[model samples]
Target: MDEKEVPSLAEIHIAASHLRSMSLPITPILTSSILNTLTGRNIYLKCENFQRTGSFKSRGALNAVLNAMKIDPNLKGFVTHSSGNHGQALSYAASIVKRPCVVVVPRGTPKNKTDAIEHYGAELVICEPTPASRTSTCLQISQERDFLIIPPFDHPDVIAGQGTIAVELLEQVPDLDAILVPVSGGGLISGIALYAKRINPNIRIFACTPEGKMLEECLNKQERLWPEPPQFLNTKCEACRLQQCGSLTFPIMCSLVEKQVFTVSDKTMIDATRFAFERLKLVVELAAGLSLGAIISQSDRLDSNIRNIALILCGGNIDLNEKLPWQQ
Candidate 1:
């Protein structure tokens, strides 16, 4: 499959079938009491944090890894670059199929995540914590070893795997006016908008980012990609903070996502993370907070008529023993 093109609906359905065979059933979408009260709109949380490997990333990793080995039995192991959650996910998935996996992560990744990757028995290579460095390291290793690369985002099978969330969301809720998804490389949102828009065009999809997304550049259809940040923001959203969005993700986002991509502050994200812990009794990761944070900070700008909203709590790979950011 061409890496640049957006995945078709049929491709997503095929990936869903592969996933179901592995016993990866649909995750639950629960109504959050505190969040609903806070937003004045019925807020449903798609709790992917409870998913296998503690993140939605498992869906894509398993799909891509399993499908590859299934096609070519003699294929070598997998390689990938991740900030945190995806590394753990790929490592866990590779362990399932008894394949050696190598993950290149940025330096200073949360110990909890790196520990999980090691626990899954993958070799971890820590590099300079930048998008370029991570990609370069991973690509170099993959090319040198002739191993299949399981991307965190920005691939056909991977995108389709993530799309399964939207398929389940519609089935669970039936009717949702708007959905706020945390966007890092745009994989999740692209996969989501692909299905949500296909099923019901009326459902609005918003990409929530912790950094200050330039509205003009983001909305420019010709650009079809996130502008490279001059300097990465110091945010606890470890899964995000990339220099720019993925090429495959950008095109889909440009076509399907709502024009106004919501940007929230790091403080708002931290507060949202704390809110989920204290109020909802859910241990959500910092990157997942972008969805909830956008709502809290931009409540006035949201559609007044929106009755039902969905938020994807994407991961919970936090170090339980580590002090919460608010405590410091």
Candidate 2:
């Protein structure tokens, strides 16, 4: 696939078929009475938390790996860098195909997440807690080992795989007025927006991110910002901690996503996370909480016409031993 190519609806459908044939369960869309009451709207939660490897990352990783193996029957292995969820997903995907995999993670990633990656049968490599360090380490390993580098969120196949979520979601909730998605490197939202917009031209796509300027500033300035400052890296929402959007994903987001990406505070995200566990009986991580937090803290900013909304609960990988954010 060309670097500039975006995934088409056909590609997304193909990905859905591939996943189904692999016996991956279709995650459910649930509704919370409390959330609906609070938001004064019909709120549907696309619960990817229950997905294989505990996140939607599984969809992209498996699709990318399958496509790579098809292209190169003699593929040696796979390599990539991730904070946590993607690493675990890729590891699980690689194992399914009986291929070796290596995951490079930052130094301070939670022990539970790192353990999960290894549990999925990937060799785990530690690197400095920076985007540059992670990328360099992954490239070095890929070069030395001749492993196919399956990036977390940049490639067309991965984006198409992620777009499968939109296909399932629209089928489940055909009349959805808007969707709130957590944005990290833009893969998830980019994929969703592409398919959702094509299916329902009037459907709105809102991006939810931790309180940071990386994405917001980039969108406002209409350009990519390199080397995000160190402070932005110190976020509680580790899933959304990427310094910038993916090169392929940013343009798609710019064209298809809502102009104003909703920013939620860390505290609001924590409250949302707690609410998910205590009230909704869902164990969502901080990144998933960002979308919920947007509804809780920024509902007033939403269009009055957006009565039926969907929130993508991106992941559920958290350290159970760690204290709740409220406790901290």
Candidate 3:
């Protein structure tokens, strides 16, 4: 998509309004006394885990689905590839409109998430655990079945849909000094940064990632570079296992988001997840825990002027039956 086509603040507002009309919950901005005390700053959590489909992916999926239906009412169905959350969200969104949906999920995806995708009425197709495999399978299915592809990220409408979170976040906490977002394919942060910076130029936007150099390297080189294969698939942060950033999302991040990306280890994310559950009484996936981990372990790196920070807990889809990260 054209750089000029990046979703504007007005577009994000429209997405927020559309989501409200769809009866999507405006997830609350929660604050924890314990977290604030630990961080020495007012910390707010934008709990997208409470969102429909148990993640913010629902906002983008539904927006894209509704927009596609509006433009082509006769569309056969929808198709997309996801590690888990986006597939469930897309399936849920498609079911609301009584449309057939197909989800191309990567192999080794948690069974709980795949079960939820099927429960939401999407036909699940498993592929190799690689970005290339996911994209190829999705494309093949889309072509063969004449399905509309609502990508998990990298699309303008989807990015705009994710941007709706920023609209809600800024409205709820207008004076936030910084916003910490977990980055995967970059859709969520791209949307948030695009709108948040326009609203408050001084508000810092931080991208928290698994302890990998893809995002950091990309930012440093000022270009997208897919280094050697990432070990994301082997990590506990399955929701953010994308090997590289999205084409559309990277440029947006390069321009609007903080230059320095925060990288967190799997252990740190697991510890953060445990902390959230034990103290904050919140269930967060490892990916969501990345932001919390950064705030907990890397607060000193933040600018001195930053005080109030908002962390986007992007999802809460973990298999409790499985050995929890801390247990292992």
Candidate 4:
């Protein structure tokens, strides 16, 4: 679909209504005392980590599959590439509808996420850890089979499905002044911004990204960080390390996100991971900490006038048993 055809808040509500008919509803938000203490504001956390399949990806995945099946009842399967969470989510969603799913994953995906993918019965196809390799393999598979592509991000249905978060959060917290969301392919933030703006045009949106890519600069230049993803895009956090934002999502972000973009280092994420665990009592993955890290580290950078904010705790699929470099 053309970027001009980006889904709106109305499409998101339609998606949410359909999802509920399938008995999939909403995820809840919770208070973050530690974050409030650190940021000195009433920061509410929209915990997608607690979402079914352990991430917000499930919403998009499910919506994509159901919509695909509605269009083509004879659809054999769905395909996509992911470092982890999206793969598992697609697999789980496909399982519920009793359709086959094939996920193209890079060689170094976290075991926790990979295990969840297989556990949901998706066929796992391993490729070299790069966008080219993953897409090539996925395309090759799609051509060989009749499987449709339910991309990790960038699709209208997927974006609309993700927007459901804003639908819930807006209702859950009536007076939220801002929302900080982690950005990779930019689907989550795009969806949320679409809904948030339509519901309350005054709500400020911000993007939080991993440091090295300089995503804000790339977005400004209309360029991507890594055409072929770098190796460091490995374990410390896989979710937000992608080279570029989605074509559909980037435009929405440039228009809607009012707050200055914030970036965080791996160390910041790891320390925040530890903080979330020790203080907040939430075992968040490193990437999940980017939202919290943005609020904690960039307190001065944010507009001082804004009072209440919400942070999207994107996911919690980290390998708890795997020895982190910090442990070593």
lDDT of every predicted structure (CA atoms): 0.82, 0.88, 0.88, 0.82
Candidate 3 structure lDDT: 0.88
Candidate 1 whole-model C-alpha lDDT, 0 to 1: 0.82
Which ranges of candidate 1 are over 4 A from the true structure? Answer: 1-4, 107-110, 128-133, 224-231
**Which residue pairs clash in candidate 3?**
none
Better of 3 and 4 by TM-score: 3
Worst 10 residues of 2 by lDDT: 225-234
Of the pair 1 and 2, which is ahead by lDDT?
A: 2
Candidate 1 collision pairs: none
Model 2: CA > 4 A from native: 1-4, 225-231
Query: Which digits, one per residue and each the tens of the lDDT, describe model 4 over residues 101-151?
Result: 899988987677688899999999999976689889999999999889889
Tell me the tens digit of each residue's lDDT in model 3 across 80-177: 98758889999999998889999998788778878999998999999997768988999999999999999888888899999999998988996899
Score residue 51 of candidate 4 by CA lDDT.
84
Candidate 1, residues 1-328, lDDT tens digits: the string is 1434767777788878888888886888877776777788898899999998889999889888888988998887899987577888899888878989999987887777788888888999888977689879999989998878988888877888899898889988967998989988778888888888988999999888876555336556547344344345566677786646677877787778888878888888899989889888888888778888888778667889888899999998777786887786
Q: What C-alpha lDDT, on a 0 to 100 scale, does residue 206 get in candidate 3?
A: 90
The local distance difference test score of model 2 is: 0.88
Cα displacement (angstroms), candidate 4, residue 150, comes to 1.1
Task: For candidate 1, report its TM-score.
Answer: 0.92
